[model samples]
Target: MQKPVIRPRRLRQSVAMRNQVRELNVHPNELVLPVFVREGISEAQEISSLPGIYQHTLDSIRGVVNEAAKAGVGGIMLFGVPAERDAVGSGATDPDGILNRALRVVAEEAGDAITVQADLCLDEFTDHGHCGVLDSRGRVDNDATLERYTEMAVVQAESGAQIIGMSGMMDGQIAAARDALDDAGHDDAVLLAYSAKYASAFYGPFREAVDSQLQGDRRTYQMDPANRREGILEARLDIEEGADIVMVKPAMSYLDVLADVSAESQVPVWAYQVSGEYAMIQAAALNGWIDRERAIAESIVSIRRAGADAVLTYFATEYAQALRAF
Candidate 1:
């Protein structure tokens, strides 16, 4: 073989050399833990579809919050699984509703140690399993849904959620939420818009985690996965409407969208390594098809390399602890 004087492999020759030249790194504070808190439960219940994850009771959720804070995870996104549901998702805005109460509990438990985020959507509270109210024709009413979202924003802020994740994919949601929060004197609350959320099949495991009531899909509202350009458009619109941060969901499969949003956005861009992404890696690892720890690290690093300022994942606490160990 001819001698290659300009070999690039020099940098990869050692772990310390590679670390020094690494383009991206996943830190404990860049991971957000998504948690489920279920009403009418006294103990934490493991989610079967999402192995090693749980639907926690209020008391049990506090422990998770403390653990996340201690692990130096950036935040915890709280999803509520209510025991009761209604046509209009009345529980979502109630002061004592399961989500709001969990927010308060998490806020108290985490204090200033971690950002307290709440899922501002009706899917978990609605008996019909849609993100919005159905009109006379049984179609989701966009205008009516915005009204519910505004109410949700105010209540979530009141419950001590520092960040309100607007994930319903409703049109004009960010603007409505921003106005509602400001009017309610919650001007300091941050709005993290699920700006480019797609109607994807990867959300199957999440339905089990939240005990979702959805009968059909949300294709009418959520963007199509095939349309990549729409992701950038949606994210820009959200930014113009006062989104403090914009997100590209199902991170692994949508890195192009995440990169597009990160490039065009002036604000922070985030990606969600959704439940399906987590479940697949776990399943493969458990079956001895992959190196579990390496896969987790690679997945997170890939998301960050693609330009996510932060990532929300089920692996947040564990990954953060692992990172700290190094």
Candidate 2:
């Protein structure tokens, strides 16, 4: 065999050489840990489907938020599991609701060491399990939802959430949230839009995590998994609507969408390594089918390589700790 003039293998000959030439590096500061805090719980409860993840009480959540800050994670995304549910998801907007209260606790625990973000969706608080209030005809009312979202933005800001994650996929939600924040004198609160969230099967584990009351799918709102270009369009629309950052959810399955959004967005782009993605890796590793730690690292690194400026993952604290140890 003739010697090849171009030897790509030479660059891969040593770990140090590959590390030095690596085009993309995942950093602890680029990770955002998503955590759940349930009302009425006395202690932290482990989520069965999502190993190593938990549903925490207000007090227990403080420990985890502080731990994430200690691990050097960029931020913590808070999801509240309320003890009560109503037609309008009143708990979502109540100043003393689980989400708002958890936001206050997390903000205090995080301090300036990390950013505190809160989920501004109604699914977890609404009895219907929809992301918005239902109209008389039994469909999500987008306009009404925007009003609730505006209310949520103000209370979340009041609760000390530095970033409001608009994950409901309602039309004009970002603009409404921005307006509400400004009108309420909370001009400093940032908006993170879940612009390209897909209605994928991969969200099953999340339903379990939140104790979802959803009886049907969210295809009426969330983007269809088949349309890649639509992802870019959604992101562009959010940017135009004043989103400080845009996100593509279920990162591993939608790298193409994430890359497209990254190329088109003028703002920072983020990706969510959702529950199903986490569970699959854990399941495989538990069965000895894959190297667990390496899989977790590779999954997140791939998302970063695909153009995610930051990633919201259940593995954020663990992965960030690993990065620091390395």
Candidate 3:
């Protein structure tokens, strides 16, 4: 046989060799854990749709924060489940609102050990379950929503959130939030914009986690998955509006969008491996259809390979612990 000129498989000859040549590494500090704290729950409640995740009570939040900190995870993204919901999502801006209160508790527990981020959106607090206020025609009032977001941003900052995750996808939201933060003397706080969040079916498990009362889809505000160029455009607008970090939601299904946003963005790019993605892996693993740990590792690695500077995932703690062992 003729001698071959190149052998690409040489690098794959052994685990040691593969490890040495690995171009992408998923580290504990690059993983962010997403947590939910319910308003009136006296005890921790499991989110059945999202296995191994809980709707923690205020008292229980400390335990969750301690566990995440112990895992050496990069950050914690907190979501609140209010006991009551209403028009304009009044609870969102209230200093004692579930989300705000949870932020305070978590910040106290975490201190400066890990980044504490709040989901600065109205959907969880709104009885209508829409991300913002509605006009007389029942359509999302974009400008009105921006005003609410500005207020929510300040409250979250005052509550000790190091980062505010602007996930409503409202127009002018970034500028409004930045201005509000500066005016309120929270200029030190960072804004993480969900610049390319899509109205996705993948949000199903999340709805269950938050007990979302959404009557219809959010297609009017969120991006359409069919459009890739728009993702880059959204990220550009956020960057121009003083967003410290820009993110693409439902990361796995939108890796193409994530990659595009990452390539063109000047700031750090993050991706959220949302609830459905997490549920699917858990379900498959339970059925013995996939190696749970390997799948988890590969899923996050794919997101990293697609250019995410960090990943927000339900499996963050487990993945971080595994990386620690390695």
Candidate 4:
């Protein structure tokens, strides 16, 4: 009743004014596309839940990568699904392993036009579906897993991956991988740490994408969602341990953590709008409940507005193309 002194609505009166005053802008380079590549397949297999996305074989993966680059996507996050699973996930580090092979394939296709990142977790490798070796009690062996991650980081880096996404969520994974990369003379290779990755149901689709055989949950390693302070702590530890970038998984659901990490991080803070989030929007759109393109833009815009420097998303290529048109 104080004569509406502020009059903030005046700036919202026009589309041009709103556009000019927009604070967080999602750019093509700020988006990273997550791709799934599988072995022992000759063609792309469509994913039911994730429409328009496919599980690509090597021959087909190249084309997808080229499309991503042409659409102005900043990078690709590679996940591998092997034809077989083993007790130790032995295939993960083999030079010709599914993930490493896909890395090489994508790198060659992109050819310096895009950043190629490989997932450095062993869940897709081990038959047990744990990130590392298991103990007698069937619990994850964290130290042993760190060792495996170290080996994987180098294998992925040598395979032409520009960045290693250390997603194991092990206590010392970032430091271990950093040392392994530098000692192997891959000093230029960077680490994109999954700093605040939480054990969330959002990863259900990712398991299918990677053909993971995980027998149990990852509560022992991945962060608990109830602990907000731990998110910042994890990000800080990764940064101190030589991570080039730190990320918060399932971006929209963890905006608080993303904001905290972004405000505190000296390095780039990335967020992942993971599989479940994508599925939710897709389902709503399919049912005619929401506009797909507008919803996608809003979802990513919210992440950027929360202070994330970049976002990893399955919708990256689509959104990047849409952004250009906008």
Candidate 5:
């Protein structure tokens, strides 16, 4: 064979060499675990669609938070499944509600060890399973939903949520949440805006994870997957509204959106490796289609490379442990 003038494989010679040449790395602190707490359940129930994920009881949530803290995971993003749902999602603003209670428990159990974030959306509490309240016309009431989110923010702050994740796609949600938190004297509480969330088919598993009661699609509010510029605009609006961090959901499918937001956003940009993404990898791995461990590491690393300051993932603890081992 003729001698090659240049050999690019020189850098791929060994594990240490690859590590040295790697430009992006996923640290334990860059992974945030997404957890669910369900009301009226004594034991944790496995989410069939999400495989290893579960709808945890209050006690189980505490245990999971403790484990995440011990694993050196960055944070836990909490979602609550209420025993009852209402038209206005009254449970969301109830301090005694499942989510708020879970927040208090996790904060008390692992506050100092890890960041505790609360999902500030009302989907799990609303009978309609929409992120906001509905109008008499049966459409999502944008302004009315903002009012609910404002109230929800205050309760979440009081319950010890270090960060409030505004997952609702309401027009003025970030501004409303920030104002409410400040008025309630939670000036230090961070707001993580789900700025560029898309109406994706990839959220099927998450619907099951949170026991979502969504009746119709969120396409009216959420960004269209085909529109890249709209995602950038959403992030800009959230940042202008005082969001401490902004996120793009379904990280793998929206990496371009994530990267664009990260570039434009002055604040930290995070990404969510949503339930369907996790389930897909798990299903493939279980069927012997790929290396489970390697797939997990690569997925998050790819998100990191795409400009996520942190990634909320179902594999957070596992990925953190794997990083520690490396």
Candidate 6:
């Protein structure tokens, strides 16, 4: 019997040939870097779990953002590590809060060259790991959290954030934030809905970066990883509710969902390379198992190949610089 009609192996002969036949490629403009900036700190504090990642001080954040801008990254996704927490998560909506301060700085440095995106979730401000306030039964209150998101949207826009990243995994969050932004005359600012965020174990190191106060799981709010079709449903709901951009969290494990959503959605699709994914690569590199730079670029490129128009990753600056060197 004939083995094959065409020689597929020919494309694998050389680096140039492989690249020429590569169907998917990662671009510099598609990379969005996630940065952790603390409220009050003298120097950058490295997160042991996420190597090469740090919680920068306000002064340090300015320099970091400036450097990322020069690297030609698509944008900076900001997460503020507050020095304090409360039941209501007041720091999230406060104009003087760390997040707002960083947003202003990022916007100033970027100035339309890149989108300054702010994580609009309350988990970073809450005393509990839950993304929202607790009810009398100690469960996350979805409706109440929506109200908080509305208020937070206004604050973020006021703080000069070009985009609000709804990463709390809460329902109705996109609609509520959109209404609030429109009412506050920030209708132009984009709402990037974390539409298919899952309650995955891959978020372990992120807890350290933002100093999460989570005691239990986030199953009720975040999607269950067992469900794939449901991600498409959630993405649809978010688009109908006014999300300017829809995203799937932890890109590597859920690339199928991202691809499906990208095919159906009218707006742009994005994916997040969560902390766990970053830590795994860092650990392998530290132990001399893999080339860190190549792994970082390859991982991000895989996500882009999976149908993400943009990606939120910790390696945005490094990857962008690498892409430009080509």
lDDT of each: 0.95, 0.94, 0.94, 0.89, 0.92, 0.90
TM-score of each: 0.99, 0.99, 0.99, 0.97, 0.98, 0.96
User: Per-residue CA lDDT of candidate 1, range 1-326, in tens?
Assistant: 98999999999999999999988778899999999999998899999989999999999998898888999999999999999999999999999999999999999888899999999889999999999999999999999999999999999999999999999999999999999899989999999999999999899999998888898899999989999999999999999999999999989999999999999999999999999999999999999999999999999999999999999999999999999999
Model 5 lowest lDDT segment of ten: 207-216
- Separately for all candidates shown, the number of backbone clashes (residues 3 or more apart, or on different chains) is 0, 0, 0, 2, 0, 2
lDDT of 2 by residue, 56-145 (tens): 999999889888999999999999999899899999989999989999898888889999999999999999899999999999999999
Write model 4 residue lDDT over 1-326, tens digit each, in one string: 55877888888999999888887678999999998988888889988878777899999988888878988899999999988878778899899988898888888889988999998888888888988888788888889888888888888999999899998899989889889999999999989999999999998877777777887799889989888899999999999999999999979999999999999999999999999899899999999999999999999999999978888988998999888888
Query: Cα deviation in Å at residue 133, candidate 2?
Result: 0.7
User: Distance from true position, residue 281, model 3, in Å?
Assistant: 0.2
For model 2, the local distance difference test gives 0.94
Better candidate number, 1 or 5, judged by TM-score: 1
Residue pairs in collision within model 6: 129-213, 129-214
- Model 2: colliding residue pairs: none
Question: Top model by lDDT, which number?
Answer: 1
User: Model 5: residues >4 Å from true position, as ranges?
Assistant: 1-5
